[model samples]
Target chain A: MAADISIGKAPHPLAVLPFYGTGAGFFAALAVLLFMTAGELTGHHFNPHVLAIVHTAALGWGTMVIFGAAYQLLPVICERDLYSVALAVVSYVLLTIGTILLVWSFWVFEVGALMITGGSLVVVAALLYTVNTCATAALHQNSSVQRAFIVSSALWLLITVIIGLLLAINLRVTFIPRNHLDMLKLHAHAGLVGWFLQLITGVSTKLVPMFLLGKSKREWLLYAALVLQNVGLVLFLADGYFNPITAKMLIYAGIVALGTAAWLVYLADAYRNRLRRKVELLMKHTAVSFACLAVGFVLLPMAYYFTDTRWVSLYGTFLFLGWITAIILGKTFKTLPFIVWSSHYRHLTGKVKVPLPKQLYSERLTVYQFYLYLAAFVLLVAGMIADYMPLIRVALVLWMMLAAVYAANVAKIIFHKPMITDGNRTQ
Target chain B: MEIELNSPFAAELVKAQTALMQVIDPELYVNIVDLGLVYGVDFTNEAKVKVTMTLSTPGCPMGDAITGGVKNALETVFPGREIEVNIVWEPRWNYHMITDEGKAQMGLE
Candidate 1:
């Protein structure tokens, strides 16, 4: 038993956390894209609509997925089972319901709804997630890569929730000053780069290698990357909230330096340990996304220095649409197939022959969507930089179409299979 | 495959579930038996025992502890029976696998 169930063989509970969390996040993000695109076309500066899209993506999609990953990972690295599966189920339900309420409040633009119920549910979900994860991790005597991911993720989630509630209340009552949009830049950064990006990096450091059937050796590099990213996020957030000039410059500088280091280390690690020597199309597209991230990061600081807000928006376009969304798109295709395969077909492994996880979806359709998104991303950035609202609107519509294609592709993998496999199996 | 009746230690196999539960799993704070993990037991009159069990999931993290706990408990209980344990993933454990008592304990009722 011990021989067959070694370090890599035994299942990690935290692994599933990332799967469910990322899955929800991807869908939420696509939904936001859909709504935001419509708003752009209709010429409505609907702030509530924007808030809904952002939260749906950040809180609903990003935070939830990170929680799932952390739950699965903590046990493996810490050498422990979760304190309770019941807690996990509870956490998932709260988060799912909370996201729905919050998004609904935003779509309706009801201050009372957003403030009263939306705020409470989001808070409850974040607290539940944090408590469950922290308790589970506390049971382990020693820390692991998974532990690091879970801990940092929990902390950022707390901050993200608080900021979200504050913003929601301010929207409903205007108790806070009207410079709320400016204040939101800080909150948004804290949630996106600090909470979501940090968690993804920590988990992906381990997951990426596991996917490639290789072990991670450079633990120190990962630690350094994590530290740099967090420190940069802290500095960036402080400056955005209090000191605009320094915050703008320092945030850009800090992110570029940190993001570059992390990216380089990521590339080196992938190159060193990567098995299945032939890089798949998903990885190829992912590489392109990283390249876009590097370009955006470097260009962002330059734009800030030149006092070109247009360039700043352009940089955002590159990062949000080009890098982040693109990476999610590519990785989702890889992850969704495996998850659907496991949930639907893992039981039938020895009993009957089945198609591989990669075969669950159409690769050709995904590839086509990837290209369309890339093209749309490029045009949108160009339009934003040139202040061409019409062009931006058109590009956003194209992006919506691409998102639909990606969502459809993912859905086909999950819902295409029946729950019971071969009811005729005799024990 | 078949338990032989000749050795004084053969009866120890029937008590394997009781024996395993005596050992505690520190992480979950529940015995393997109470967790409804032990699936079957086979004993041979030659003083050998075989224990089969299942885990909560394919990639259970505390599998080592549970298996080790079972071995330790059995060794302490029978002292003379040579024990062999097998962990199987077939007919995978789910909520339905839990006994009514286990279900009550788990708050699944």
Candidate 2:
């Protein structure tokens, strides 16, 4: 049957641009914060500046862009219209204000009304996001497993943020009966595994196949992964909160590992059947991201055993700076250019020759950025483990450079103007 | 994929389809015709040209681009003839729809 030509219009560019713009801005800010706090980093994992950087990267850089891309993508993935652009804008405003306030509070090591207010705003934003995404998903056929992943993760994010707010409150009043550090670890895991990992897995399941023009009939694997990962995470959080310190945590980690394996295997099989045989630069970045996931998978259990604060710091670095940042860096070019290109060039398609999405950004800069990032990530991980301050400093400089290059490329996409065309059939 | 030589529209349809070949799927880097997105080329009410098509995937991120390309492609061939694209979901697109030439370009066997 003929579908309506109106087509499910994706989110307006205005609703999304702020997130990507602010996200890039946050990354640049994070790079500067890294250099400024390079000295304080060698100490305990709970240092103020490190906390600030983590929040900035997690909320501002990572979640902000994800929220933006999600608006543009969920419509396509779920094959339905976004429930409300206005709701999305409201969430972005709250998220923006909340993130700035939270990062500032962390920077100054404040645990009073300021931090609590920031945490409360963040909680509301997360709750609003949950409503927006779930309502959007509910508007579509419930059959798409990706919707389940996304909806579940939104719940986890709400939970994660609520726990964070409670933690902020706990910091002032010492009300939480459990150890503060233990609860903190639970909060991080709920966000990381429950929110980030599951959300990434769910989105990628749809995207990888679409981009590759490949089909993998491995729905069972994702189903298994969804069940195992979520179940494992819930158990881990419950045990961590009640029991506090227990060897049984390793068992829960194993369950999560198995779930991660299902996702990895699903992706590998999809790649095997890919019609697009050549893996391009962006896919290579994706490969690097999965590798970071692997490194994280191995380190997850190690974090449980290692009492060394250095291991904890390294864990945070690899998870945030490596796994999250690399994927976003690569996918930003993949998704954002197309979003911008559609905005600029959709009407011009048959009328004239228009640039493909890939041509909108500098390939040379991206290649340099990718290689520089790899080198910096490796050196940073190595430097931290080896207790070498010089290497760490070098890594930080390289990271700042990478951040600058990344911002330049993002700016290039965001501000890409329409090229004049002679209205020739150049396709 | 046969042209009816006896029909008055055969030559014009061939030319129109040939022009449509330039409308490539940006992500797959293959022309829509060879990619098997075009289902038919026919004359509609008042000699208006109609191109029936489907995307490689339903609701593809590139659906609008390729469809816009189709309009421009045909407009150049049949100047001033209004072109309408009717997108259908029937027998939803599968990998086998891709022609051998399309497969070769994508490095598929």
**Best candidate (score: lDDT):** 2
How well does candidate 1 score on lDDT at residue B30? 42
Can you tell me which runs of candidate 2 are displaced by over 4 Å? A4-8, A421-427, B1-8, B79-82, B104-109
Say which candidate scores most in TM-score: 2
User: Each prediction's DockQ?
Assistant: 0.04, 0.51
Across A274-387, the per-residue lDDT of candidate 1 in tens digits comes to 543556677666677677767776775665576545565556556656666666677766555554554554444323444556677889988788788777877776776666
**Candidate 1: docking tier:** incorrect
Candidate 2: residue B50 Cα off by (Å) = 2.7
lDDT of 2 by residue, A247-313 (tens): 7887887898899899989999999898777777887888888888888878866776877777778
Model 2, C-alpha of A277: deviation from truth (Å): 1.8
Residue range B11-98, candidate 1, lDDT tens digits = 6544665566564423223455665667777665458667787775434444554565566666666678787878876655544554
Give the range of the ten consecutive residues with the poorest summed lDDT in model 2 chain A.
Answer: A418-427
RMSD of each: 11.3, 2.4
Give the alpha-carbon lDDT of every model: 0.61, 0.84
Error of 2 at A185 (Å): 1.2
**Total clashing pairs in model 2:** 0
Q: Candidate 2, fnat value? A: 0.39
